[model samples]
Target chain A: MKIEVIVFGMIADIIGKQKIEVNNCSDTTSLQIKLTHDYPKLCQQKFVMAVYKKVITGNTNLNNGDVVAILPPFAGG
Target chain B: MLTSKEISRYERHIQLPEIGIKGQELIKKASVLVIGAGGLGCSALQYLTAMGVGVIGIVDFDKISETNLQRQVLYNANEIGKYKVEVAVQKLSRQNPAIKFITYCTQLTNKNAIEIIKNYDIIVDGTDNFATRYIINDACWIANKPLVFGAIHKFEGQLTVFNYKKDNNTIPLNYRDMFPTSPAVAEVPNCSDLGVIGVLPGIIGTLQATEVLKIITGIGTVLAGKLLFMNSLDMEFYTFEITPDVNRKNISIEEYLSYDYGQFCISESQNQINEISCKELKELLLNNRNTLQLIDIRDQEELPKVPVLEELLIPLVEVIERVSEFDSSKKIILICKSGIRSKLAIQMLQKKFGLRNLFSLEGGITEWLKN
Candidate 1:
């Protein structure tokens, strides 16, 4: 399955891309592993995953063409 | 008892059914303290003053710099080098002479946070650092004050209200509920380093002011248990539910007093790496130590690169991938512009490969260059 991932804040700097297309990501866990493997820098960052405007955790299945947002907490005033 | 001048000034606000004369009176009776007079505080303070918030307190120890003119609209070129709260209070007082402005030109420390916050009805956190944010959140929690939180980075911003009291039986989620701990220093750089769009904070801070007004007048639902995420680049806004952590213990004032906020937020464990002063590093370099591996974790574009210090250039983002290339037997010394990223790099490497021979150059290359 193909999924569109949108990265925000510092994560985009680490990934070097604001939007990315990934293939063969079936669940949130697998997608997380694949992202960390592809971009090793993301493993050290703390962010939450949201699918279709809802935050999800732990093995949430993803459909083809789903949009996933990776949002890291912003500390600036 | 509204004077004809006050009535005309707040005609738009008084015209609303939700915020009639009673709500305006409530606003006039409320007291709010804004912790920082930077980007977020600039907008929040402006709207709060214009909305007739009675007693507004501005707390900031920083001065206006050249770079602050971009987003901090409160200060102008003429006010450069002047204290932030002093200038902010001056400008806000002129804009709304009916409102009272209190200024705290000193930093909010653990000893003073609780006492200072207890005097206000609401606390607004406009600080850019995690240590101060945590301190303000903990202080608000202890004082039982509702906290209006706002943060911005790059093109994105977040806003939420914490510790807001709704009923006698329920407790709202605080900052710790959403983020149990601060992100690694390398993960979240300050606006000075990463850069933020000038208008992003204005939007978020306005929303923060709106939330504060809603809470003060009891007119609408506040963002007490929800986190609002916004991206100025795409103009996307999303609010997600934040559940309070049941396992999280209530922080006592004693614990907050003794907490090492700076060390805890920057580096979770100080024992992860040895810290060597710049003078000591100079001696080691002068001694012709071949076993010392100096790693520069700063971005390639960082200025004043040390030509004399023989080191490997591994930017912070690529440190983990290139960690294996370093010899485990050599004494590794990580250096960045301000020593923050270097410490984060040391913590990352230590957690992954258990590298014991790691040391972060204290004060980084900037200090080393001074020597």
Candidate 2:
């Protein structure tokens, strides 16, 4: 399935603003695996993914066309 | 007849339809204490005072710096060397003399968190770090005072109201419900390390003040039980419904205080990459007679090619995958557009190869371009 993983802050600068389509299973962990496998740099750099608008831990279920955002630690005011 | 002092001072607020005589009286009677006179606190104070919130107390231990002027609009060029809370007190006093202002020039640690926040009708969190965030949340919860919270980062910002005493069950979520665990501190970036769009905080901070007014007047929708996440780039906002975390409900203020938020949030070491001024790096490059190995970790598409005496092309993503290509023995200083990726690269290199000499070019090539 194709998952549109949006990146923010420093993470966006690293991954660039684009959707990554991965042929993967249905859970968030698998998508994370595919992302780490495709983009090796993300493995060590810790990131949080908000599926739909709520932050989900690694094992949350993912479906087709789900909006996943990769948010790095926010450094704002 | 209106008192001569009152007529001129709150004439504008008195003219408003919703905040007419009754609302004006509420403002005169209401009291609010804002914690942390940083980004959110500065903006929150400005709007609340301008709106005629009667008594506002600023609790903060930090002093203003030249860098704080970027988003902290309360401070000016002359006030650079003053304490944040004290300066805020003086400036806000002049902004609305009808309102009473109190200033505390001390950090709101667990020891004084309750005593400081107890007297106020509401508490607005403008604190930057997690330890203070959690401390304020728990103290407000214990005091049973409504708390207006605002946080901003880069182009994104978050605002929520918690612990509203009236209809308390309707507004049950706190910060803990959103983030069960405090993120490692170094991981939590602040405006100091990452650049912020200056007006972003103004928007979120205003939202916080709005919530405070709403709760005080017992009117309008407070952001209770809902977190509003806004992205300025798109001018879009998402409201996430939150419920109290069952796991964390039993957690007490003492437990919250016991947790080392500093260590929890800032897990990364001090050596992470950040931009140093080009002038400083230039002095180091010229004065030191040592040979340097520069690694450009940007994609081929980025502009303003770095003209260094010695440099190599190694896109940040490819560094870990193709680690064998470069001689790890050499002194490898990483470079990127900003300093964030290079610092992440340094972490990867350190963990995988135990590489110690890998230094990140502070502020990356952007700083280099200025030189």
Docking class of 2: acceptable
**What RMSD does each model have against the real structure?**
4.9, 6.1
Give the number of the best model, judged by lDDT: 1
Off by over 4 Å in 2: A10-13, A18-25, A39-51, A54-60, A69-75, B1-18, B165-168, B263-371
Q: Write the per-residue lDDT of candidate 2 for residues B131-156, one digit (tens) a residue.
A: 67877887888878888888877788
Model 1: runs farther than 4 Å from truth?
Answer: A57-59, A63-66, B167-171, B263-297, B301-371
Candidate 1 residue lDDT tens string, A1-77: 89999888778888987889999999888899999999986887888787876655445899999998887777898
lDDT of each: 0.84, 0.72
**What is candidate 1's lDDT per residue for B215-302, written digit by digit as tens?**
9989788988878888887898878766676666789989988876763343437655689899888888889578798888877777
Question: Which 10-residue window of candidate 1 chain B scores lowest in summed lDDT?
Answer: B263-272
Quote the true-contact fraction of every model.
Answer: 0.66, 0.35
TM-score of chain A of each: 0.95, 0.80
All candidates' chain B TM-scores are 0.79, 0.71
The single-chain TM-score for chain B of candidate 1 is: 0.79
